[model samples]
Target: MKSLKFLIILPALFLSNLFAQATILNTIAADPESGIYLTAADYKNNQLHLAGNLSTNNKLRLNDFLGSRTLTISHKGQNHEFSKDSIYGYRDKAGNDYRLYKSYSTPYKILENGKIVIYEIKQPGHKQNGFKPLVCYYFSEGADGEIYLLSLDNLKKSFKDQPAFDSIDANFQTDYDLIKYDNYHHMFRINRVLAKL
Candidate 1:
């Protein structure tokens, strides 16, 4: 009876540990290099797992295009390529998470993850004669795990019914004014607003 009980409990304990590890993997912080590292178990189970003291120093390379991309991870001097559908998400050394967007067929860097996950997109501004191109940053929030681009106009529409609308709007207006005055800290201010929301 003792041996049988131990046998039964062993598998249960193993499964519980696996689930706990999986949860930890899902919430890992971003790495300094912004490279996606994988644990050996991740490859074995074909799931996303946090890299735990993995010796290989190679950075994962993502080849992205307009609507599709491929990920390449190197291990033991061998490169393994995976398609977009095969990957779920990855965390950087800094604790930032990124996941593949099936609709756009690309990966997006997650800025904030909470009740609403926010992702960042950087777009190149058009250049004119004798002027350098500007980089435009946009953020998108996830609704029920669906990503939707967040614009100033959309933000107003989304928060119109919330009690915190007045405060949020005020901060947004102030940030806009600062941007107009070339303060350049508008993005930080916008993030502060989002945090409050």
Candidate 2:
């Protein structure tokens, strides 16, 4: 009886925890005043701009692409599904922008927009000792539009030869330190420092 109760409770707890960690995509808002007409117009006329001077001006509907691992674009009523690997990023009719990082398999929405764009990637962590997945954060600068992996080594390289570099470098020796210092906040803070230089 005790073993039966334990099994039931264990599965319930596991399911609850699993659902708690599920990834939720942010919904981009569209203006209702113009409605579908406006979205269609934008999709038809405006280009789907991507990084590296690439863009697709073909008329396509955004609705055909959402909620799928692959992006399906409609051109002249013909549907085409683009491989995630080939797409670097895309902008929707609502002006919501997304980016695909090389290190990550799927595209992530750009939470913050500026000279640098920030996005998060959730990947499986090292399981040599049986650990769960970990969330990795990344940033891309406007200059190159290349995704730079967020790590202590990359940070040190970025801030190298700058004023007060030694002090800043010493603080982020481990992943724990980076997490404690707030990687998202520090990325912006470091951007400011880079801008000044």
Cα lDDT for residue 48, candidate 1? 45
Candidate 2 wrongly placed segments (more than 4 Å)? 1-70, 75-78, 83-86, 92-96, 113-116, 123-134, 143-145, 161-187
Residue 101, model 2, lDDT: 48
Candidate whose lDDT is highest: 1
Question: What is the number of backbone collisions in each predicted candidate, taken in the order shown?
Answer: 9, 0
Measured by TM-score, the strongest candidate is 1
Tens digits of lDDT, candidate 2, 1-197: 99999999999999887766552212212221111112222423433432111123333333323444555554434566665445555564455555644432465655554445556666677867367777777666552366666666765666577663675575456644543423655545444434454
Kindly give the stretch of ten consecutive residues in candidate 2 with the minimal lDDT sum.
31-40
Q: Against the true structure, candidate 1 has what lDDT?
A: 0.53
How high is the lDDT of residue 193 in model 1?
Answer: 52
* Residue 79 local lDDT, model 1: 77
- Candidate 1 residue-wise lDDT, 84-168, digit = tens: 5656666554545566666535556655543345566544455563354443333434422555555566566666788546766
Clash pairs, candidate 1, are 29-95, 30-92, 30-93, 30-94, 30-95, 30-96, 31-92, 31-93, 31-94
